[model samples]
Target chain A: MEQPEELIPKKEVLRLTGISYGQLYRWKRLGLIPEAWFIRRSTFTGQETFFPREKILKRIADILRLKDEYPLEELVRLLSPEVVPTEVAHLDPLALAPIGPEGRELLWKSGEYAFSELVALACGAEAIRRGAKPGEARLLVEVVRRAEEALRAPTDLSALLAEKTVEREGLLLRAPLALVGREPLLLDPECRIKVRLDLEKVVEGVKLALGGEGRG
Target chain B: MGERNVTISGAGRIEGGSYGTVKIAGSGRVVGDLVAEEFKAAGSAKVEGNLKAQRFEAAGAFRCEGNLELEEGEAAGSLKVVGRVRAKELKLAGSAQAKGITGGYLRAGGSLSVEENVEVEIFRLMGAFEIGGLLSADRVEVELEGRARAREIGGEKIVVRAGQRSLGGFLSQALGFLFGQGSHKELVAEVIEGDEIELEATQARLVRGGKIKIGPGCRIERVEYTETLEVAPGAVVKEEVKG
Candidate 1:
């Protein structure tokens, strides 16, 4: 079986992080960790638990770094990907690191922004950072905003900025395409890929930025 | 007196509502969801829907059809929950059966049976248990009078003693009548991981921990320890790797 993301065994994770089994399971029960991340697979020895390499490592790191400052319950609110701050009404989306000055060009109007709008702004800002045209960034924002529900489960979601160029006789017409969908996104042979943004990372970044703001 | 006290001294049924104290001395039933400051049931009682109470005490058969959110609860007879049970501290004397139980401290005397996981801060059991999924806690102490089974058991400090039925044959007989007959003082788990683990009459596929002590009558397939490993006589460990 071919997995798109690398996986690490449960034992290896404990050894690498020097965390105890108690801490791992405790975090899991407290919702500091997502239940879906625990992937049990049958190995030659016996049944074993595995995790997505990057996601688990980063989540454990975040928890360890913040556990001292906040209680486990508060840490869940701050760090758990399962917890989307749906009630957030941020006054300045640009102040968030993920949606900085690059988002200025994409902001339609900004008195107060909801969580989904902030995520949209972040997507646009990230696209702009990747050298996308302002219009293209706006298009990506529009594509990602409707999929705000994805932030709760934020896994295997991809945002594609593509172009389909049609040439007839001596004329060439370019149509910029923007779409958000689950991974393994198929495209037409004529469509050239411009930027492929992983929505999971973008969503995590926005969540963390919002969490920081909450604490401050 | 914002008086809302439901007292059913005999066989009766009442709709669920906010009550100061619900005292059911006889067989009774609650129709809908219930939120009460305190609930005291002496005879057989059943809650058809969810229940939220600050304090709860029941003597006879107590059954909850829906989930129960309790601050403190103590039951003398059989307690069964069809859905998950979330309590700050729960003590059951006879037997407890639930879909899932997560709390701060849980102490069960006779038996505990759960379909999913029981994640708590401190778990202490005297007689026996059957957990389909993981049973994890900060500190797990089990004095096995009969047999227990779990898919996986993990914690910080785990100590399982065998045949510590200090209450003698009376309670064991009662427990046998409730749960099952005494087969052996043992625990069966696929994996048992903790910081400090001490086992007696435990059969596990893998036992991973630091400072592990395996006592008599334990049959472990493999043990991977970091600090130290001590196995007493009559314990079978197929493989042990100490780091």
Candidate 2:
């Protein structure tokens, strides 16, 4: 549902963030906040700027948290998902528990995996070990696999891991889904255990293991 | 050479080459160059290499890291191209950000940002538009609903005016007003050169044309016209030079 309260005026954002106009504009130029977010509105006084309240606030907080640790350019690279090469052999086996022989084989067969794929594999393996049927685990893996292949940049999987429900043999099963984009996957109701993985955390872990400083 | 359709429904990656038709309903990635007769994506797609397509359509987010060449393209959601884009017809209703765009016809209704030059035969815009470099077109029409900016605009015929509200537009604006979501309407340009030009609600540093009509809500520092120059009551022009 759309709400009027979703937008906040530029004045309000500045007041809340305690930042000046120059800082806001500089950040905008540096690609910290998207130009689309700077909405122009006709007010009684004149034209004013507005932004998506939640998104801007979160971005501002992220920039503040990481500004000291990294430069603006580095922050852009970290915040923005850019596709990069990753080797499957670098993944920690301990973290990929419950990965069935088939899933492991798939990883071993492929020389490299996208970061999103790594997250998906780990989630699917964990789900299978926690009581998901083989088919259900495969579906989970498929979701992440597609995301890894489709996305050109580093993807934020957290948005994709929404809780979903499935019906099988007249029984309703809550299937916690992990996704990267808009891919749809079917899950079997035979999966009984709750599947939960912090994909963001996993991405950070993968990045750190790959010698990149983890996100702030 | 043979007609083929490849659809990726889940997470998938294509090494990138040539295909008859490539469709993505889920997440997809292309690592290298892609040549497709038709390309459609309903989900998100990322291409790390150049993309050449006869027709391209995307309803979800689409990103291309390298150059893009298409006969026709339509985007109803977000699109970002890091390199140059060359198309015959490009229509956008959601939002687009491109490094540069050269097309035969360009129509945008939502938001657009071009980091470099935009050269088109016909350019039409209704919502927010920003160009960091020159915009050259045979014909340009903009019904401003929000802020529009360009470094320079050159065309055979250029028209910039306030948005005209139809029945559906009035209803939407009424709802937006009730919901406190109304947008401003303004156009800003550093320089404008055209054969014939009409401007309203525009702020420009210099305007040079063969025939110029400065309508209401216009502020210009200087104007140079060859044949005729008409200034409406609400317009402000500091200096006028006839050549």
Candidate 3:
């Protein structure tokens, strides 16, 4: 199908990109998403931004590809074309071509792979930001494993890894128990703990909050 | 006290006395015992005797000219003493790196790294404890590693690389180790929330969201809800014992 030249509405853009309206607005403000690609409304209060169909789709594809390693600013720097004034007569009219069909297909497949990896990476980054060592990422493994187990077996789901005493014999990693009743663990946005479980019963206990998958 | 900030400097002694919140700067030295609500010392301060405070912060170059002590109403925010600290209870929130002997109980909410030569005469924990230095205690309890000196002595768990002539504690009670060594009984949790906590070597329960590697010669009690948990062959983890 021949793509339209005008910018797509917010709902359509969000449907294509799987991003929220708030995220898109923030990205635009941060220059992660190009302002040139957006069509602004003529009015003030009712003003809304629209994404050009091709440009928005391309940006979505690029965002999916680079979400793992690159931040929004870096992605913009790499993908956005250099702007030249129309008054310059000797400027090159050369425009960067969109990723080809084969490339786009590869990117679609790569999106799935990137999604899972980005989830794990995002979790890791959050942990480190909280002053945890990189090696502490294993905490998520147990979380994911319990989530998987819960999906596989439809039991109580909150009694999987109960807190049990284990001797520190020949063990390499000791579990930190400083998060009993503090911050609500955000297992994605919807799932959050209202009450904390016992520290000892946490292991093998399965009140896990799964992210993106296994929520059903 | 009404939040009075007192500064001690230049080879001074307060004998056996008390204050509100002390802010020691500029090569200050205290020879006698001190009791205060809060104490902060920086720039080559030396405390010759015991110190008891509600909150203690020692930065820059500090020396425990004598024994160090703290009480339930006292604590240390960040303690870095090159010399020995012999107290009944030592609680720290920030990083603590002490070389001298810790005669009494030691507790911290943050990371604890000790030099190879220093010995923790008594190691106790209300939080996590990380020891890169020598630890010699009757009993030890920490969320992370117990004592990781280059050559660790007897306690409960001794897990570190490149160590010889090390004596590990054998089991007499449940879980292969006794729990009564002037140390409280506490388990590591995946997440803890408070003003502070200490990380221990043996029971470093972590709330992980990403990849983690339990290093060689280390021990893990439990790992709750994380992305990945990779263990080296030398690492050991005991099964969880449910109540």
Candidate 4:
């Protein structure tokens, strides 16, 4: 008799990525994320969580382009069920700034990058413009950073979740179903992707097809 | 005291550890402290010291130059401040609205609205909150809206509609993305206005009240509701899901 494919545990996937419990289940239900590959263990902690290389990679790519224009349920339906790998582009520079007196010192030493950009980098100015608190936007920025890193190298998912800075903790890495691949993922208009002015103009020319502004 | 009225002019101060009910009219000044179950300042009242009260109301123009603390006992009152205010916690049932509110902790049963400008190092709310300026907080919940800018954001169901954008709509999208996808429970949303809705990083059963129109600008995380979902042609979605 032939043996079935080895299955990975969900816990392991979460531990490897550091995504939140809520995110994991949300993705699973959306179908953007595949079902958990469970493995029975013999030890006391007799369960394991594993994800397919392709499935997780695809999700990472899709999440990076997350937007707030469409309902989550609808997005799942619109997304293509295909997997393709892509190369990692240049690592963007992330800026952070200190707030309080203690944080001011951190800024003097350049340890603080521009958090404003980080907020803009995550989803866009929609949240902030829509009255989302700075702290809330900052969290989403960090999450986006982690998501990007994971997409670049799914195998080294650990590195994608490393500390964003000395004082900051990279908790966003814990979200489940980290995807990393070259599959063409749709970029939501709500995401605050900082596109160069020249590139933005070009994108605008192309985006006219959909009758929307492409000032990313 | 039933409804006794006390009027004090400029530079004068009133001192009291505890009272039944004190009503201050005109530009009454309090230098010492006031501890009562109910305190109302009609015109402009300034307190240099702490003002502890069970129920506090500032109708027209009220200012708190010092800390204002309230016990959990008094949680069924509207603590409204029109003028400048500096209090710790204005515990009330309705909402806490102030021009300039500076304090440590403020717990409100209803919404927390800060008109003009508000500068607080730490502000926490239990219901929908709206701020005009910078609001630095460790945690937040329900719905939130900042007219100008928001320093940080954290909440389960938050709606912040400012400028041309809608805060409530953004929150609904984020919630849908995080909780609405293929969730065992339904993620329902009712929009009485336009036909545009987006869900990002949320999961739950979704039910829209108006025409379901998804924009190309949307980035959804998941969607797995028990019932079928209907969408208008303009809707653009990109995510994953299962039946």
Candidate 5:
């Protein structure tokens, strides 16, 4: 089983990121930060807030980097994973930075692609970037496309490809399976995890890529 | 569409629909949802359904069964909303109650009770409040006349003070019944965080800020500060850490 993701305490996040409580709350109110990211747990000192380590750090970095250029309201549209850019429809999926040339193979019948479709294509493209086979990437895209409902609670969600070996009549057979669910996605003893992708990050990337194009 | 004006001078009952100006002088009850440009009521008025108006003014007892959406609203005696309230500007004089409130400038003179969050640009209260969830604002100023409890309070600049003893009977008797009878005015919260903070007569588990001043009659379990920390003589803090 993969190690559960690290959590950074609220105080530590403020210290490490050099952001004050007011700024954090303001961003939260503005929807630049998702409510699901604020994980409240009862620590020794009453109730304390925590955030996923890598995701919070990356989100804060992106916000701090772009806050100067774009208005905070616009930043919410560009960065928030919870915001699905449904109004976006593009003729070519390869134009987005997150998809790029690697996305060429994920195309099915591409006159115009909706926002979620582009996100699915971007997921497959990202899988390919991580050295997965084209077929495996396609598998991930299919699973993620059906996972539209999962985006409502994007935090701690994972997409994975597992390979299982079966012995039948003294013959060995391999089966590959793709699935998506909340994290700590466990597989049985015979299955081996081939690829794991944090869907939150991929969703953010797709939003950022397509969002700028729409706004600009 | 420009709907006709509706006015109930005395006791009346009306079906809820679109209107221009709705005024209820006496006891009034609406059956369904109301969409109006201006809603005005005096004495006891009740809306069984949702209310959406550009301007809303209520006096005496007013109650809405569904949500309240207004551009600007002011209530003098009592206002109660069963569902959430979204307004650009909300001013409550006597008492107000809601499930949740999200607005711009919110000023309450008397008791303000919210089941959940009260997030606004500016929140200023003169009497008592009990917020089950977080009370967050750009600027939060509370002049406490009675006991107040919020799970968490966060803002840019938060200043809370104990008001001089006035309105002793109505506030004390009403709020005292809710939070148990306590002679001294106090604010209780689990966590209080802000950039610039100063508090008095407050009890909190954790107080965090950039510049924090623990004023008189305060008991805090832990205090974390980045810039400046000052603890008054009467205040008691279990732990103080400057980071």
Candidate 6:
């Protein structure tokens, strides 16, 4: 792709922003602007950095506007992708993508549900449709939700559900947990249930499945 | 009261204390020193005092005014630390500016600018780095795409090579020339010392190693090797010594 004329050099960015190099780097560290936005290019003199002109100008303006109202730490969260606790009952069922009507209904029936919980419920609904028992599927969803909560990040239901097996009292359940990198953790010692799921994979999956829903 | 997890989802400030996991999803500030098993910040965060954690990860902007001690540190946004940093693994996919860093493994895919010394067991850079002080590592590998500089480097095994410029790079350079874009593609260092060393597209003052291989686009003031040495076609060495 051809270079856009809107790319402003680092020196120019500083001059226009009326900020020093120290302030620029400090803001970058504080997450006022993303590091990827700092574009490096080979110059006649040496390697110099550049930034998208309008984007940088606007970002700096926003930072200045909110600097006093919120501390730097709080500003980072305000500027980042919002993680709102969503209630399934409050949302329109038709707007959820990839999830079928049955799955939507199942999620709506559940009380308050976070976005990750909704994804987990969808996975459970899919498993039940695939001939798994209803009770076992519900257990799977609960387990996936717990795992997501433990990870403290959005969890992927598809990948987590791919190899998950629900074991019943003294009987071999459906599918055994696929422990890729980590060891097995005894979630319920009395129930003799052990579940191993790749936390990183689950997080990545949730990000992919949810698309833009959880980003904001 | 001890909390298992503490999450700040809005604009909030946390007085430094001990916690199992500290997560900041929105803008937050830490007033005093903090101790946590895991510290994760996705939004902007600032720590006024020191921080000790097993794992410290930030995807957005983070700034630590005091010292930071972490077993594993990962940053995808920008991180600025005014005090010393000690970590087992430090991974950067964004930009990091630190006063001094001591780690076991340092991997960077973005830019790193350190004002003081950097000592690591392994140092790998796929992006750009500038170190004002001495850099000592057991293993050092660098594929330079942007630019890299260090006052001095000491390692057991060291390899430095130029990264391939993408098609976008060529286009930008062409446009840059016409539109006044700066184009500098070279690695600069004062001195390099290692047991085994390989260099390409680097400009340095002195290099001393047991076994040395100088590849293309290398300009060196002096080279001293104990065992073996190989010089490529496009390398320029002002002085060479064998012992």
Instruction: Give the winner by TM-score.
Output: 1
Per-residue lDDT of B1-243 in model 4, one digit per residue for the tens?
454334454435577566777677666767667777777676666666667776676654455544566542233324444455554454444445666555435555345566543333234443345565434322222222221123222111232221121336644444344334332221122111111223322222221211232332222333322223433344333432322
The per-model lDDT (C-alpha) reads 0.88, 0.72, 0.41, 0.37, 0.88, 0.68
Q: What does the lDDT read for residue B240 in candidate 2? A: 98
Residue A166, candidate 3: Cα error in Å is 71
Give the winner by DockQ: 3 or 5.
5
Give the residue spans of candidate 2 off by over 4 A. A1-216, B2-4, B166-180
In every candidate, how many clashes are there? 0, 12, 71, 80, 0, 22
**DockQ category of candidate 3:** incorrect
Candidate 3 lDDT over A1-216, as tens digits, reads: 222355676546665666543355445534455545556554332334466676578667766776676666555444433211112121111110111121221121222322222222333333444444444433432353333323222211221111223347765443432121211233333232222222211211111111111234
lDDT of 5 by residue, A1-216 (tens): 677778999999999999988889888877788888889998777889999888889999999999998898889888888877777778978989989999899898858887777778888898789887899889988988888888656778888877889999999998878898997777898898888888888788888887677777
Task: Give a tens-digit lDDT track for model 6, residues B1-243.
Answer: 666788899889888989999999889998999999999999899999999999999988999999999999899878999998989998987678899988778998667899987877788986678899767777789877667889777667889988664547654453344224444546798778777899998898778767999999999988877779999997999889885
| Per-candidate TM-score against the hidden true structure | 0.91, 0.51, 0.26, 0.28, 0.90, 0.50
**Candidate 5 C-alpha lDDT tens digits along B1-243:** 767998998899989999999999999999999999999999999999999999999999999999999999999888999999999999998889999999889998878999999988899998789999999998999998788899999989999998775556776565555435555589999999999999999999999999999999899999999999999998999999998
Task: Give a tens-digit lDDT track for model 6, residues A1-216.
Answer: 223337898656655776543355445544456655667677663445688687678667767786777677665544522232344332543244434554643553534556566556555656556655555556666666665444343221122233444567878665533211223232333232233233433333333344445444
Q: Which ten residues in a row are the worst by lDDT in model 6 chain B? A: B174-183
Model 4, residue A31: C-alpha shift (Å): 36
Flag the better candidate by DockQ, 4 or 5: 5
Error of 1 at A118 (Å): 1.8
How far off is residue A201 in model 6, in Å?
A: 55
Top-DockQ candidate index = 1
- Which runs in model 6 stand beyond 4 Å of their true positions? A1-216, B165-182
Q: What is the DockQ of candidate 6?
A: 0.01
Write one digit per residue (lDDT tens) for candidate 1, span A112-158: 78887888889889888988999998998898888877767767778
| TM-score for the A-chain in each candidate structure | 0.91, 0.53, 0.33, 0.29, 0.93, 0.40
| DockQ of model 5 vs. true complex | 0.66
Work out how many backbone clashes candidate 1 has. Answer: 0
